[model samples]
Target chain A: MSRSDNAFNQYLDLVRDNAAVMAKGRPALLEAVNKAGASRLAEAIEAYKPASDEIPECRLDRLFAPDYGVNIARVPMTADVAASFRCGVPQLNSLLAVVANDIFRPTDVLMRNMPEGLTVCSLRQVPAEFEADAAALLADGADKNSIAGAISDALAHDGIYVRVAPRTEIEKAVQIVNIFNSPVPMLTPRRLLVHACEGSKVKILLCDHTQTPAVQHLNLQNVYIRVDAGAEVEFYDIEESSAATHRLFSFRAVQHSDSRLTVNTDFLSGGVTRNEFDISVPGDGAYTSLSGLAIVSDEQICSDSVVLRHLGSHCTSRQIFKNALFDKGRGAFGGRIVVDEAARFTDAAQTNRNILESPSARMEASPQLEIYCDEVKCSHGATTGQLDERALFYMQARGIPRDEAKRMLTQAFMVDVIDNISFEVLRQRLHILVEKRLSGASADCSTCATACHSQAPEE
Target chain B: MEDLLKVENLRAGIDGKEILRGINLTVRPGEVHAIMGPNGSGKSTLSGVLAGDPRFTVLGGSATLAGVDLLGLSPEDRSHEGLFLSFQYPVEIPGVTMVNFMRAAINAKRKYLGLEPMSAADFLKTMRQKRAVVELDNKLASRSVNEGFSGGEKKRNEIFQMAMLEPRVAILDETDSGLDIDALRIVAGGVNKLKTDQNATIVITHYQRLLDYIKPDFVHILYKGRIVHTGGPELALELEEKGYDWIKQEVDNEQI
Candidate 1:
């Protein structure tokens, strides 16, 4: 075996052993633990050490510190509640749907009218179909020693696996809805694996939401995507957790030859959110685009960190992240792009723009590029400023109220990102969601637009 | 006829330095009053003070618009009360389309007047009609407000906005500063078309060239922060031929 493989096995063994000990007293979580073959993941809970310098000081240490004393309970999903969730996605016959309720339990998985040979199953059920492939894909790629990864493995209950057959094209997007209905603070970890085979095409929308604002939970999610040769994958990650919840999201993607991958992360609301992205182009002629939009206010904090690497010749990658901050909100964007020596003729660019509405709002942006190849072109830029005073006065001179003018300008700043969405209905829905979030209104569901009301004028 | 605007002994300045020192002017309905002056003669300052710009402090003044006290109103409130100021340098607002900006302004005025927002069809119809007044490109109208527009296009956009708002008293501040012949003609034509028997205009310019297009009924030559000479259209031709040196000489002689 390769040296890296050997190290990976050792890390897995350590996590499994630690998890085995931690799972001894928790009879409720044992079945999922045994099914995942992840005793080592439990072991990682205690053995993991965080790199303090790499992470910002945001009370993340206390946030990630494990609390194992809480009891695990399943929130029952009634048929009515399930039906309400269906309204989030458009009525399409070709959609593959998966619904997970609080505590990372898959309440429903339906593959209706999907292309022949496509496989969609839970992680526990993956062994019944493609045992070897599922095991290798799940156990690989992610750094098992990181605190976020270790905690996700230790508390993971359920996950979904989607495989698109070679040469097949799915016209409709796959929808995954995570509904958080916990009445108390709980730690829920979930996993997702998407494999777009050679020459296949697929689109996925993963939405995380809460049933009520009263729920306080820690949601840990790890997503892995592999795009094969000549395949195309479009992924949208929408996080609209309640103000009381903290979300830690880690995403990793690998692109093969001639493959195209586009990933957009939209952070509408959360208490303390951290998103990490690692995208690698390992084959020639591959292309990747990573974009993010975050609107945070009222002391909320959102951070996005990305690492994009081009390891093959003739590859291209681009990234743009924007944040709109209001009140005492804080935001950070850290992005790095690397082009290896062999990755000649590579083109990469990264840009981050932030706008602050209040004097107390804060933003930090770091964009870096590392190019070892001689024939590669790469650039990065960042900008942080307040709303244009001239623009504000211009609008005000046209009879728009000061408050309304501010709102209009803020909405205009997000048009570049919102216009990138190809779907018409989804784009309009996102417009409403962004407007509500900017006005400091909390939305109940990320996917449902009707639940939010327009902010009333201050009397 | 009742005066559309009345300024009595207006004394205003910026940073405690007097600019408009005890100036007075009046405009009755259907009158086009041109305030021509040399540079630093407080021509633009007069327009700014009248528009209720917060940068300037009114030490002593009583300016009334349509029998209402204009000094107590905000800039937007003044706009709602049938007052408009065509900025000398229109500010560029990125990401705000001209359509949205115009709509917001129209609706704000409408709301203040206790009227419903204009229907989308009517709004678009009005936009098309007014856009033709200045010959503004359809593409430019849909783009961000004044963003990346040329000097002439920005001036044209300002006039187009005036046509849409249809204010009772319009103040054009240096409207002919950077315009070619064709653009100047189009802007002047739009202003003339919007003129009505119940409305008036204040044209503040340094040159008499703009007077050739929009014929002014009264020409007031302001020198040293006050109106030194008021005359007919013949005075503009005389000033253009003899130059502002003659006016400054005349004002200096009067001061002595």
Candidate 2:
């Protein structure tokens, strides 16, 4: 057999060898994992090709190899540990009240930072009131087709589940911190389930970070959200890992009637980052807005795949994704919107814009719309180009240096995404972080601890 | 008194095609010189070459502002050395607020001059004082630079920026191209208010409408990349009355 075949077999063998340890006493989940793994083992090598036409350049096997030995280490989450982490980043102290926080490791989940009005615990130990609903949601959305999906599904037996009370509004946002620090090659699997009951409102922030740049690893995450009738939910996910780490983040959310849902993803730094979003509006009068920004450089790659479905009448969805690439960086965006025959008066629009700062930098964008109804409004557009040289010269002629002019233009390109955010403090904090990233500041967790301290905004 | 701006045998072009050929000009402090010519006569090229636009290369020439070598410095450095160009078409920069853009420009110049940066209060006060010269609205000052601005508003903004920087040599390149009579009057009035014995101005135009508002000490007629005549402000009116056919005929015959 060839080298890649051998690696694939070795990966399968590792998954089989650690079945019991990774399963965490969930028999049904293990059965599902084994079934999915067996089906994949039976398919031809061509099965490893990219799953979508928009991702022709993708090599799925190389991008995702759980060959990192499956090693599970547990660390308790205490007040001191949480406080130290919070104190390291000064902006976080003033920006986030952190109503609920949880940290996930390679194969373990630790939940210690818990404020009032939030129920944070392992999926296996959910309270009796929310236990049945959480399990049903997970079983319905579980990945049952691909190798990585099967592996993550099995590891998700030890995932975190949160529930926001019905008819209530959360005063502060909930923070979910996922930290991956491993000495050996490992695959960290994280699963999060959030259920907002009827007439409830909540905002969530998820951050992915690596402790060091020494270890090579992959973070596979699955997020499932249910927004009930008349509810409003906002989810923001930010990824700032080291260059040695790869990330496959997925989010699937369903909305009921008269609900509003918004999801924003910011990919600042990573080795190879792919974010998948699937939002479904099944009830009439529901609205969804999805926005994302990615900055890639130095052989890094970041792609976002989004699918929005309108199934009920008068539902609306809007999506905008922007990417800035420099120094051989690569980026791709695939956005698709579907409106059913019964979903009359549906309004949907998708826009993807990119800037390539270097000759070697590349980007691909594909926006598609499928409408089976007569009275629906749908539009999509994609553009890829370099920065406006005229604008740069204009700024320089006004006494601004060329480098500063470029930075200002780049930052300006990303302001619309940040402007859509409803939180004032969060918007201000993101502006600073984006400026720092554009200036080539250190984005690793360790450097962030010290860099953010000195760069904090003065009162 | 020393010449504020001296251009000697300056030749430049874009993409290897020479535009400004054997051009010579001099402007003493407190003097306003107007360069008038028909279309494609290199009126704007001189302003671009002096402002150090990379597109138009300096084939063989020398330009000095305030006794400083202008050709050797970058565009920002030239601006810091007291040179400004009011573009015919002002660029629209989205997402960059006027406040931030002006602050960055002012601070960069200050750093080049070895002076401390301006305080927020001081900068705002300065902005307010200069904004009135052109009747710029308070809302426009907080928005992005020239984004979604009308033609008249953009012209007014250019003069406001000129007033803020207070350049020693200001080159207005067709600033009155898209302006109405009222806007032309306001912009020219602002330039006149900012004039001083320590600075000079160059007004490049195709018509004498702007010259009517801002009187010039001397008028130069540029033809075929060369200045064919130099006279007083009446020269603009004469060219307006006789048209460029007479001058073009005379220059073409001389070249033959």
Candidate 3:
């Protein structure tokens, strides 16, 4: 055998022989408990999750109802399982689906953005591949928890980003579908990093989900977006996990000056989806918008938001969070608009409005504003109540069904936030999807439209 | 006479407080009728009860449209049956765009009528023509339904919707409340343009302004919930000049 074969065999021998050594105590680092270079890394792995006392089981009917679709790819994507990644200095950035090379670069992301000495690794292969790469990284003297965290971050970015060419313009919106199928109540961590260059605009739909009839899935994802000057970024992350899971999904961005970041998070599912949006303007005149729409039902879910806006001078930040709940569903909002003591001329506004469709449904919103600057316009407000019964009656009297009227009102409630998505096609497709989801899934398949179905490009 | 709409001794209230004691009226095609009343005389309440605004409870009586039980139908259903209520206060649905709402409404009505759904091109064309009647701006039409609309614009939009629907009987409920002279004229103009000899309009107003523009052939003075007086266009003029005291005194004396 060649020298490379000898090295491969040696690695495999190491993995097979140290199997008992790799299997450690619950929630402990498998191979990094003995590493030397990184002391804080093993302690970080201690933060990993063990199963909670009891498992929370739910019915499949309440999960993927008959009307709701059963997309094959979406199942795993929405679960948003926290896979592993290896942390090393990235060397290559390409736009390929899968690469089997001896390179240290992430070859999937179209435009890779990394600081010096940042290595990107993820669980991108089969079981054997995972074991081999994990063992190799362990041999490289890297700590387990830090590597796990770094891998989570890199996987998050790779998972959410579209891997088209740098110059390839995606006119239609692309959805970042994540799924978690783990039976164990594991603490799945994710970090998404993006750097969109000039004029390359894309709208992302991040759909997170977990399996039905399972214990609670705790998912944690952090997103970092860097839009180069003049590159437009429109992001919409929909957290529709099964009500059996609890998700802590934070989508944060570091926006360069003059780059626009439009973000809309939809919390239509999950047992508890706590979303934190930390957006800061590192450049003068940067624009950031954090808008959201959430629909809750049954004894299901609640979403809390803590938004931090460090808008620089001449920067603008707009926050809108809308919620619609029925039955025992509840939604809570705590948003703060912060302007630095020296962030002069900052314009920021926050609004949290909720519509409760049932007497049992409840919502609480607290919108706050903190401005130390003199020449700034900052405001915050929140309102929570039931859908206007009069409106329902009017529509019903016009021959619309009561349920249909409720759906329409809810749809109308989310319109303001939905309209902010600048991409027309993506906006329409999403609108269609939301209407279907709200109205018990109608028969509108935007993908089946001529524009998408045609062999050639036809809009 | 073929009655297009019939209300028989309709008594209603909100939260058990009786507002509309008993309202009886009949409207047929090719005619315009106006209901004029003083403040809090249940003018808006009548429209609300007719349109099934859930805020009010129907104490008694019923309303029928084109020989169909109008009270049993939903608002969208009533609209499908050509019963349009140009609301006094239209709702502002933040994310639902004007075009989307209209399309949903139009498709719903069409589904009931057993007609094929209109294509996008046709819908846009029809929207354009009807919006012209109200002289609505394209930017406003493209925005969310009634979102950030001024009082006049919302009222005019009601008329524009009335035009788009081409209902059998359009109920203009206090649509003139917040409008200036020009907006009232434009709204009334849109109503008049949409009114064919086949359909009628029920203009609910407190002032003679919208009456002056729409020119209701018959005017009813509702006093303490009932139509105490019904006459020609001159009744609105008389009420405008003399106020509501004469009709109130007449009801009081007749009762006592």
Candidate 4:
């Protein structure tokens, strides 16, 4: 066998050994994977390798281990759990819905009032006529070498596949919520695939929540999107995990000629969270914008890595990421923009701004740009500073208490990113949430999932 | 009249360099005291010390407002105790609207006085009434505090705030330095209208032009960290005409 084949077989052996060890007292989970034909994909997992160096040390490496001591047999996949999970879905008006209760386990998928020629269904429930096409799309959509992608292919049980018909438009936003309810340490790998046909338009909101703040789990999620010519898509990812949870999220998108894509990632809470976004504009007149806001405090660590590439002429891209670090919390931002030789007339800009509230709070930012084209406009900037003392004194002189003044200034610093959300209701909700988080009010409720559960109807 | 403010041998400095060497001043309710001096004469230092600014170290001083010790209170507490300073250069606070800022200030003072917070309707009414006293634009009142405001607007905003707070003692630090004829008239008029027999005002200026609008009961020439001369409002006009050279010559002649 060639060296590449040898490496692939070695990776397959590792996955097999891990599955055997994790299957201890969990025959149902193993059986379910086999029934879903994921066992066949495990052999192909060898072809993918983990990009370990791409992420920093989170100090919770055990969460990434394959056999992190979770017994899927003990996790009851009952109808009651599914019902409870569905009750927690945000009361938003949408036509497509996907609710996942635990790691790699989707509890429900529904398509309501969808436009003509649209297909939406769970990976395990795809119709026989579309099975082959769905499988091929999954296999070809994402980069298998990335850590999230490799783990997802080897362990993910089910996911959602959405295909919009050409010339179709969906006015409301499709909502996908992932609910984690495990009492023990567990590992969950999930995936989502979307293909916007030529001239189609869609909006998506993907949210993650935990049932309890005490559960320790590892969540690896990957999203793959394809924007066809003249298509437009807006995707939002909001993560509100518990303190004991470690989350790794990767989003990748490809834009065709005249297509537009905008992705907003809001990292509210987590233990050791890392998010990555990679987009490529390979067709002329394509546009891409990525914006993110991360609020982490206490001992939490949050990082964001973004890479945008302009491979065709007349492409435009802009990115802005802001972070607020308090207490001993740490944050990192790595942004890169590349203009290829053929990408003439490209206009790209990136900015990373951070505010450190406490002396112990830390932030690291790196912004870079690579330009191979002469006729391009590209700029990048990064800033990390404390609150303005003059502004603080100004407020205090107005008879506002010192603490309230600090909170007001901090909120003002973050409003630039929060106010950009297109939806009014969601924007208002996020403003309240961000204000509470900045004031250390949400420290006790590490799991927003439980907060949502309390509002959910009891079955 | 009751004594509303008393400063005795007040000594303050920044970075261990004494600025206000030994100054004595007292003001009764309904009195307007103007301290005129050349540059680097510690006119601003006295205002800084009274406002409880931490940047200045009080070497030796005793200031009181209505028999209450002002030196021991924090800046906010001093403000709550009916002390207001119209800053020479107002700091720009972005993203904090005027309505919210005024409400917070009003509630803080109310809380200090052991009263319930003002209702929104009442607060807005008070804001409208006070804003008109300074002839401030409604649009400026809704925007962020002093953000993108012109020099004159900033000064007018300060006077408007002074009107809103209704302090027992108000200090105008260089309030007329950057104003034109119309702006100076409007600002001085606002200060004059807000004056009451139960309150006091201190006008700190180098020129006597502002005194032309709001007459001062006392004019003191501050030189070398001490008040070398104290006279009626005519002292300001005399200093403006003869300059500080005459005052320096008189002080030197006295020492000889």
lDDT (10s digit) by residue, model 2, range A302-416? 9898989899899888888999999989998989898989899998989999999999999989888888999999989999998899899889999999989988999999999
Model 4 interface CAPRI class = medium
Q: Candidate 4, which segments miss by more than 4 Å at Cα?
A: A1-56, A59-82, A85-98, A103-118, A128-133, A443-459, B252-256
Cα deviation of B128, candidate 4, in Å? 1.9
Quick one: best lDDT, which candidate? 2
Tens-place lDDT per residue, model 1, A133-235, is 6655677645454656654554554577789989998877676767665455666666788889999998888877776466667677789999999999999
RMSD of each: 5.9, 4.1, 10.4, 4.7
Candidate 2 C-alpha error for residue B234, in Å = 2.2
lDDT of the structure predicted as candidate 2 = 0.80
TM-score of each: 0.88, 0.91, 0.69, 0.89
The DockQ figures for the candidates are 0.65, 0.88, 0.48, 0.68
Candidate 1 collision pairs: A15-A40, A15-A41, A16-A39, A16-A40, A18-A43, A19-A42, A19-A43
**Model 1 chain B: which ten-residue window has the lowest total lDDT?**
B47-56
To one decimal, what is the Cα RMSD in angstroms of model 4 from the true structure?
A: 4.7
Displacement of residue B22 (Cα, Å) in model 3 is 2.8
Candidate 3 residue B80 C-alpha distance from true site, Å: 3.1
Q: On DockQ, who's better, 2 or 3?
A: 2
iRMSD for every model: 1.4, 0.6, 2.6, 1.2
DockQ pick, better of 1 and 2: 2
Candidate 4 C-alpha lDDT tens digits along A1-459: 354434233334445666665455433422354323344445344344444543344522333543443332334433444444443335455553534444333333343366576777666566676666566667655555453455456565556777787889887667677777665566666678888989999888887877656877777787889899999999988888788888878788889999989888988888889887888889899988889898878888898988898998998888888988889989988898989999999999898999999999989888889999899999999999999987776666667778888888888888878777776556776787787877667633233422334234355
